[model samples]
Every structure is written in structure tokens, then in C-alpha cells.
Target: MKKNVFFFLLLVSYMAVAQDTTVKKLQAESGRVIQKDPKDTLPKIWRIGGLYNLNLAQGSLRNWAAGGDEFSLTITSILSLFAFYQKDRHSWDNTLDFNFGFLRTTSLGSRKNDDRFDIVSKYGYAISSKWNLSGLFNFRTQFFKGYTYSTNVKTFASAFLSPANILISPGFDYRPNSDLSIFISPVTARWVIVKNDSISAKGFYGVDPGEHSKFELGAFLTANYLKDINKVLTYKGRLDIFSNYRHNPQNVDLFFSNIFSVKLSNVLSASWNLDFIYDDDTRLFGDNGTSPALQVKSLVGVGLLVKFGQGRER
Candidate 1:
């Protein structure tokens, strides 16, 4: 895995050098020098934008005959940001996503509803109108400590970077359009990192007892898509599949996520996010917490919608 990562990085470096050489040769044919125009108002080649969502709800029961909570509150926030660049044959894109939710009531007071942090970066060189040579780097983790509640006890589950996932791959991407991309990789490297000692000892997310990290060499494929169903509705989704060549290759790992949005007005919108995952190495689900099972999560909110930027959404 280390050797493959090294070679992939080296190949990218060589490609950059070759591109630089071509640029120099092209400049040699021109003798006139152009000065930067102070009055030029052209847009930059790179486009940056982000969307922020904040949803809040509160309920109060006054003189309630039926049994009910006196006060209840729910708050959820999600932030997504992206920067994309396309110049000549080279393109680079980066994105960050964060989410957190809080819930409070008279019975279950102030429990965390959700938490996650994820980032992705990819670079591609166009090989054709519909194909590109690409490399991807992705990292996913959570922001806060997580807990599993029982009848009377709460068990510690995870913390920031306690069980983060990192993936690196060199692949070919087929772009049918600006809104969709499918990447295929025969070689992929993935790492599961457990930063907390206590968590590592417990071996929650595929790491062995007392081990800090686990490495895997595998094949990975990912697809990203975005579509506008209409003027007021939009959808985004991603799919990932991987198979470890060394251990249990027949049992593939999968991750799928979907996001849907409906615009009600300029400042108000409804959104829903659904995520599902299944890993051969993770056996933390089911009634015994020792058998592998599908994990699912979803969040629905109606809140403020704020978007900034010009070009595409990824």
C-alpha cells in the first residue's frame, strides 16, 4: 500500500513537470508580453461557494391534560463548501462537509442527534471530451464524542478522529456531463485510524486491539451525481464500493448517500439527507454488537437556505 501511494504521487509530479514544459515551449513562440489589466473584470478560473443550513424548532405545552414534555427543542446545522478550478486540460476540486444536531426534551435532555466531518480533494487531467485521468484523496470522520444509550447507561463510542477513514486512489473518470462523474480504480489504498488510545483498545472501527491503524489495499469505485429535478427541487448523491484484495475480497464494502432539497422561498427550504454503509470488517451492529449489519442514518430539516458562488455544485 505504501509503495503504491508513493508511485501514484510520483506519477502526478511527473505529469506536472511535463505540463510545465509544454507551457514553456508554447511561450517561446510568442515575443510580445502582455501586461495585467487593472480594469479587467473577467471572472477567475476558480469558482468558490458554500451552502449553510440552520434549522430550529421549539415546543411548549401549557396546561396539558395529556402526558407530554413541558419543553422540547431541536436544532440541526449543516455546512457544505466547495472550490473548483478548470483551466485548459487540468482541473482541481475540493469540498468540505460538516453537520451537527442537538435535541432536548423533558425526558431525554440534551442528547446529540448527529455529528460528522468529511473532506475530499481530486485533480484531473482531461484526456478526452468525456474522459479524464484523475487522483482522489478523501478523509471522513466525526467532530464530537458519540454515545450509545441503554436503559440506564451510556457507552462511549467515538471521538474526533478516533476512527477516521482515509482513502487514496489513482483512477480514470468518465464524465458524461458537468453534473456527473464516475471514477474507476484498480488500485486503491485505505487506512482506518484510531487516534484515541481507549478507543483503539476497544477496536471499534476495524482497528485491532491496541493498534492505532489498519491498512488495506483494494479496488475502489466511486460515482457522484447532481441534478435539478425542477426549478425548486435538487438532488445530490454519491456511491462508493470497495473490495479488499487480501481479506474477504468477496464481501465488498459499500457506502451510499443522498441529499434532497426543496426550495420554498428565498430564505426557507426543506432538506433531507440519508446515508447507508456496510463494511465487512465492522461488526458493531445487530443485537449482539458482534455481527455485521447495515447501518443507516437520516436527517430531515426545514430551515434557512443560503448559497454563495457562481459555477457548479459537487
Candidate 2:
């Protein structure tokens, strides 16, 4: 009876030791996995990223009753950069967006159909979890010469920096989540610049005749939102409005943009973008002549896309 009792006690002790050993082994394995995770080494204060896309299209028509170009080709390229920072109670975000495209038709030859360059920066000091004091700056211009190819004649419309815009606003920023932001400013400053001597002399783009720049004080509001609807679909939108107190306060300026992206693969995607603008001072040429009107542009493309850097943290 004494020998049986001692053996039973020894077996119980052995099982306890084995269980402790297994627990220790599991903890060590978990520690190794945690150490190997890349997120543990990634920087939290600064995030940077870039996106580039290239698209091409071609069409050839044989003899058809409906008249069309014999052969046509279009090429477009878009590049964007992002730099964002967050630490303590301070935050800063900056972005640069550029796009250019050209089309070649058998009748019209080669001509530019799209050109845009925009830069935006915002800095904020937190006043609460969802509100902050913010300062915003934006600049917009075009890359190359643009023309109106009406009546089979190419008439020069605009050139680089001929109608650049600069805007600065100090206001309150509201951010309810990582994907949405809103800003409003009661006093905003804006400048319309025409660097081209000929364009400035013609009083193009809201600038006074013979003047290179025009200044205005206004009220401004801006909103931006971005979201991924699913693993393969994404959307982004922005809206901006300004009312000039010194000029036509009733004729407010408007700008709106939207983008949708569908991922087809790791490196290929399809995208659609639309932009609308209405500024009382800016003129658009129509069948009659140049007049202030709402302007709209849209693009659809499927192409290769390259992305880099860490994504936004929630």
C-alpha cells in the first residue's frame, strides 16, 4: 500500500511539470511571433506614399457609313504623393496630384486634352478628440499649353502658370474618423496669378488687365472623404466652396471631385474620375464666345498602378 501511494504521487508531480513546460513553450513561441511582426517596427509618426498610373487606348475604323477618325490613340498618366504626420497633439498632411493626357486623331493630329497640377497642405493643433485649429494652403495650375481646336484652327487658350491659383485659410477642422475631414474659415485669402505677359494683358483668369496677380478675401469651406467599400473597391471625394466678400458675394465658387477605383490585380486596376468647377471670374469658350460657365471633366481608364509606403493607420 505504501509503494502504490508513492508511485501515484510521483506520477501527479510529473504531469504538473509537463503541463508547465508546455505552457512555457507556448509563451516563447508567441513572443517570437510578436517580435517578427513588421508592424512592431514601423514608424507611427510619419507616413509617406505614392501612386502612379499609365493608360493607353487606340481605335481603328475601317470604311463605315458613319464618319469617324481612321485611327486614333490616347495616352494618360497620373501621379500622386502623400506625406502625413501625427504626434502628440499636432498633425500635418500634404498631398501633390498631377495628371496629363494627350490624344491623336487622324483629322486633328496630336493635342492635349487634360492637364492638372494641385498641391494641398494642412496643419492642425488639436483642441479636442474631434476638433482642431487648422491652417490650410492650396495651389493649382496647369502643366503645358492648352488650345481650342475649333473651326479646324488651333487657338491658344492657356499656358503654364498663366492662371495659377493660391489659397490660404485659417479655420476649424473637424475629423470624426480617419477617413473624413471638414474645414471652415470665415476669413480666407486667395490669389489669382497670370504669369504669362500676353495672358495677363488679356485679363484672363480673373486678373486685371496688365496685372500679374489678383487678390481677394473670402469665406471658404472644404470637405474630403475616402473609403474602401470592399477589398476590391475604393472611393474618394472632395468639395470646396468660396464666397468673395469684396466682389460678387452671391456668386460663390465651387469645386467638386470624385474618384472610384476597382482593383483587378496587385498591379492593375480600373479607375474613373470626375471634376466640376464653377468660378464667376473664370471664362469658358463656347459656340458664341468666352463666358463664365460651369466646367466639367471626366476620365475612365484601366492601367497598371504602382503603390509604395505604409497605408493610413486607424
Candidate 3:
């Protein structure tokens, strides 16, 4: 099934490229969508840009916080590159992105590592001024290493796992107004990994006979708004709701994240994120002496975004 889907995406991409080439050839000969103003007729492209952030925080009991953190830090890098061509009623878009990050926390004088890497691409098909659909594919990985408890033993199987990935996601966007937009994505992601029989008991990577990675569904809903704060600075807010459903354990997890951004200029920006998560099946099989439902939350994290390009305007 995954292989078939991949082939379909390849076919679509090729077809789109072929169509674009033909369109360009015809336009060059007849001067299609030519502008009266010479400045508007030149190819307009927005080059890619990226952002990197190093987050450091210290939480202590004296701070009156519900949770005590023994000094935690995270470093994240996000890069996005896209080129768009607009001619009259039609538009062509291409995007590529990569993100890699690591988080470290000290609990009870012991340090732990959490790392993640993601790569994604999107090709958009514009149907109208207010609507467009896109093809999305992404691959992600989280690694586990070095442990102090028996629980840590289970982590070994997750390490070095090839990766969990999304073959394709067909998504849509709707703009009700110039300043507001909404979007939704229905997607599936799958993975193959090994695990300690004693720990996964049911098998790892959901390969335990009755278990499978099928129907690993996910969805996202987002709201975006922007306000101008100055000639060069603008403020924006994004509210996002995300969820994941895996059939093996019959579980559903949901996340809510809100981000505030301040664009310093075309090439630099800063953001703060507040995220919360809820899990419907945090418990293991047969009560396992663990809670079956769970809720987790986090507050404001500072981050930064930067774009770099040669002879390119961000």
C-alpha cells in the first residue's frame, strides 16, 4: 500500500512539471499574462529562509511551579525553502524543509536525551484565490540512548530505527478573508522498529500478529492572524490543534499549540510557543498499574527564525 502511494506521488509530480513546462513555452511565444509595467513581468520568486533556536531554562521548587526541572535545554533548527510563480489565475508553489533538534533534561541529578529530526515537502495546486490543495510528505525520527532504569532497556529497540514516515497527505486551505485562513490535513504515518520482548511484550513497531501500523491517522486544524506593529515589524498568532490515532492500542492523542511571532524584518523573526497534550491511552495493557488516560502541558518557549539566501529577498 505504501509503495503504491509513493508511486502515485511521483506520477503527479512528473505530470505537474510537464504541464508547467508546456505552459511556460506557450506563454513565452504569445506573452501570456504580460504586465503593462515591465517590473511586474519579471519572474517573481521568494527564496527560502531558516530559523535556529537555543532554549535554556532552569526550574526549581522555590519558583512555586508545579513541576521541578533540573536544568533543561533544547536546540532546534528549522529551515524552509520555497519558490512560487504567479501568473494571472494560476500559481505554482514548491516547498522543502528540514528540522533537527535535541532536548536534554536533568532529573534527580541524572541526565536524559531526547532527539528528533524531520524532513518535509509540499507541492501546492491553486484552484482559486480562496482555495488550494497540496501534496505533503514527511519523515521523522526520535532516538533513545543511555538509560538508568529498566524502562530504559526498552528504549534501545527504538534507537537506530530507520524512521517513521508519511507517504502522502492531501490537504486543503480556505481563506475566509485576507487576514484569516483555515486548513486541515488528514494523514497517515508508519514505522518499523525493534523492541525488547520483555518490554514490548506485544511486539515492537506494532508487528505483533494482531498489531499493525495501518490506519495510523492524524489531523491538524490551524488558525492564523497577523497585525502590523510597525513599518518593519509585524505580530502574528497561530493556534493549532493536532491529533494522532493508532489502531494497535486503540489510542488517540491530541495536542494544542499556540505560537506568537514577531517579525523583526524579512530575514529575522522571534516566536514563543505554548503547548499542551492529552492522551486517551497512556496506560499499558491490562491496567499494568499505570494510568489509562493522561494529560501533559507546557508553557512559553522562546525561539527564533532566520532566513539566508544570495540575491534573494525574504
Query: lDDT of each model, Cα atoms only?
Result: 0.89, 0.88, 0.49
**Which ten residues in a row are the worst by lDDT in model 2?**
33-42
Model 2: colliding residue pairs: none
Query: What ranges in model 1 sit over 4 Å off?
Result: 1-43
Per-candidate TM equals: 0.84, 0.83, 0.52
What is the lDDT, from 0 to 100, of the residue 77 in candidate 2? 84
| Candidate 3 local Cα displacement, residue 266, angstroms | 11
List of clashing residue pairs for candidate 3: 50-306, 51-306
How many clashes in each candidate? 0, 0, 2
Q: Is candidate 1 or candidate 3 better by TM-score?
A: 1
Clashes (candidate 2): 0
Tens-place lDDT per residue, model 1, 1-314, is: 99999999999999999999999988885866888899997757799999998899899997999979999999999899999998889999899989899999998888788788989899999999999999999999998888777567676778898879999999999999878999999999999999999888877777899999999999999999999999999999999999999888999999998989999999899999899999877766666665677878898989999988877586
Ranking by TM-score: 1, 2, 3
